[model samples]
Target chain A: MSTGGGEAEFEAALREAFERRGREAPAAAGLLEAVLARRRRQTRHRVAGAAVATALVAAGTLLGAQLLRGGEPAGPAAGVPAPGIFAAEEIELCLLPGGGDPAEVLLSAEVGGEEVQTAISEPAGDAFRLHVERAPGYTVRLDVLRGSVAGEPLDGARDVRAGDRPGRIGDAPGGGRVLLLETGTEGVLLRLTAEGTGPGDAELLAWAAKITVSTGRDACES
Target chain B: MEFDDYVLTRGDALLRFAHVLCNDAQRAEDLVQEALVRCHRRWRRIEHGGLDAYVRKAILRQYLSWRRRRSAEEGPAGDLPCAGGAPDQGIEAIGERDAMWRLLAGLPRRQRAVLVLRYYEDLPDAEIAGLLNCSAATVRVHAARGLARLRRHPELTGRAEVVEDA
Candidate 1:
């Protein structure tokens, strides 16, 4: 083996290989049509998912209204507080209960007459976690954890429970207010917590009562 | 240009580029197809003169990100091709080409990519850097190390003439 012709040989060999491969490469053929078809299907799926999420949100709102009917609601006193609303933005592909994309959900509401901007959450296991900045060095968060099963369904309390069953607005560890809501869906739970000069127990409960689900359907769903 | 036009002109070249990077036709096809799908999705957002570079970058990224699927059931360390051998004199051009492919495959993924982009794509360091999302200095480092590894390959050991060192 000599080093003398190695460079020439390597370059020549690469060129030859490229030419040979070009001769065997497939034509564009049906590729364009296939891509277009995929895009169309994704659009349809997104539209359908959004519709489903909207229906769920409406049902959940009804349930929240019913739950609040029995309790003595607190007045907003000096300022009107915003409801805790968890709205799904874009659902990621293959992360939903029905084998669709995971929804990009957010939590937003007004606190004390000021409109708090929206905030997105980080995905954690079967939950989406959101942290909202209330003031300098003070914050609050909402964790929406989901669970579902197919075929051997768990009745209304299991797979298909709507998103509005009320539990209790109680003390959470670390001095935060926690509202546990059994979402109308069987396996979904919305845990809303407010800490440091954030929403109070009554406000958090009201927010939980007004939780909404909006779907941002993913355009890349398979 | 329209997305379809871009695909018609650049699809085969992207496939060939993938083949060189992965050294397997099926894997190359899959990588190129995945990249094309992604490019199609973001077609409107991509700038002019950017699609080819974007697709190339996507293919390389997919190739590098693929998980190694070699099973434990396969033969262990002894299964690797020999690292030390003089380039066989009796072998024809096709054999030499294969020899080169083997040597190229032996390098680490990034080094192999740098060498292929440099020699096969004939891309300049700055451009290759842009495609790889790395600095030009890093590209040079990869190219230098890759060429050094090729020079040290056992197959090229006895070759009277070696390619110029990077």
Candidate 2:
């Protein structure tokens, strides 16, 4: 069947088809409840998984230390390191805010030491994912979000400074290090994650220091 | 606006939009639900404005990146029954619409997305490009190719011409 009218007629038919199909959609009853329930379940699973992983890491560390010390019994606090000097694993970072519109990068930073490509994945959202060639397969993600840093993993984080901004340094899950810093803007927090087996904490901190978080109109100005 | 309140008010519309995007009711609901969950998480930041657009973008992203769904090689499925149409519509028109639907389902995901956004959503090429993360030229290319393929389909070629003549 040839529509002598051509493209315009075909488009009209297509639009009508879409409208008809759209109207047949089922009612979205209980969708909000389902979403909330799924979110809660996911949170529970993450928390439980983190707890198990942390326990195993702590126990393994204690056992290894004991074995190294000629089978001497390790004390309760033996495996736990000071806040500033955490094992390169066992820290869990909080999830960044979702649904942020991708914004243009108003500021940029240089990553010293490693041959890394720094990109602002969502500059408006203040999130950056740095692909460090030195680490081969690992990615370093830095997310800046509004509000002070408050979460489960911050319990043992030690205070540090990135540039002039105050921040905290701690171990991150999967053999990585996390640096949480306060940006120049009051109430905005920045999180830098050097994935496991990637750059050392010192290098990560150095890279963090190079970042300049500006208080532009957007949440992630820099 | 509160997250729950927003969902209550606009959930059906979002679901409908998702349905048009993916051409599957169940998958559409899943997309909307996932987008809403993300929206709920960041409602505090997005609630100030453009909340609907953000959620719609989230849904579109999820639909585009959902690689685990049906393979691209799969054949286009038959269209679901249209709920309502013109009172005087005839069988030929219905057949034409069904053919169009099947042909649409056969197009590449991005092309289908471009067509839907252009015709159904009535969005500009630039806006569709933004949602799809491509240039406006690419959007037009997709739309052109998709429409070309649909018009060329053996099923719609004759029926579409007849409809146009009518």
Candidate 3:
């Protein structure tokens, strides 16, 4: 696939495509910055905590506990410039159980206004096949990790199941695990593995979710 | 990644990819911007793994899916006029590239995905198979069909479509 003429032509095509985009990339910074600002909630939360602790420490030695408080789990001051990304921590998910085969529910994330849906399959023993892709219709930025389902409903999803929260995930036909969590505003579908029984199926979900995109150094340390 | 850091890093590539996918320069910028914001809110996890890969796939899928549904329900995209054949130049022009874009748009999501992964990202069939939900056989099929469709475009000529020669 790398003959001389072929390589030249390919280079030309790629070059043309790149040039065409060069004209439009200028405004992208503003848009990306705005989006990141929204996610900066975590950073804001941390800074705020530090500010509060500092003020308290000044107020009295009673709260000087701030000095020895581990200082918000320090990391390198900032990210290196070239990686084109910085990150905080991976999403941490806590499972609530519902009973049945857990194959039905999956975890989801969105990227670039697109939906990235993920489901864990028990195609065999102990090993899980991850199904990740974009879904149609509503757009999302899926930052997904680990997934499971339980035999019965999870306490949070079940207790709050009736009110403002609508159930986006349902048990699979012939019944399935049905544990769902509304983490903040994001939704997660948990299911059981192959021969899957009720909700709260696997332990992998917690570990996987935390292994988010390799953008943030802070998240990596955790 | 932190919101600021995400912008710092991915702004350019995501912007470029989104531009190609959406056609409208401004809209691509908007879509990428919006996506990143959402990603940031969920940055804890989204920034991990093959983040670039995940982000690229997500953007294209969202762009294509939205385009598909919009075409079905709305009058027209207005900005996205149906892209059609133009002569192949010795060096690809902006217009010729746009024509290739249209051809890519014609492919099924999986086929398009295979071509993008195999040809663009240069991911192997196994990896492409993992990316899209199908067997390696399915990846091969998609690649074959995707190439065939590209070949059918009159502008592609003997140059673009010759796989072995490529």
Candidate 3 residue B8 Cα shift, in angstroms, is: 1.0
> What is residue B18's positional error in candidate 3, in angstroms?
2.3
Runs of candidate 1 exceeding 4 Å displacement: A1-24, A41-222, B66-94, B156-166
Worst 10 residues of 1 chain A by lDDT: A151-160
Query: What CAPRI grade goes to candidate 2?
Result: acceptable
Local accuracy of candidate 3 as per-residue lDDT tens digits, B47-143: 4766776666556555544223233211111232212223344554545666666766777766765665665456799977776657999899988
Q: What is the TM-score of chain A alone in each candidate?
A: 0.39, 0.40, 0.25
Q: Cα miss at B72, model 1 (Å)?
A: 21
TM-score of each: 0.50, 0.56, 0.42
Worst 10 residues of 2 chain A by lDDT: A108-117
10 residues in a row with least lDDT, candidate 3 chain B? B73-82
DockQ of each: 0.13, 0.23, 0.15
lDDT (tens digit, per residue) of candidate 3 on A151-183: 333433322121122222334354432323332
Cα lDDT tens digits for candidate 1, B1-166 = 8988987787667767876777765555556665666677677888867778887987776666412222111111112122222434456644655676677778899888887788778899999998777999999999888877876777644331433342
Ranking by DockQ: 2, 3, 1
lDDT of 1 at A17: 50
Estimate every model's Cα lDDT from 0 to 1: 0.55, 0.61, 0.43
Q: Please say which candidate is ahead in DockQ: 1 or 2.
A: 2
- Candidate 1 on A18-56: residue-level lDDT in tens? 555444443445545655565566568768966865665
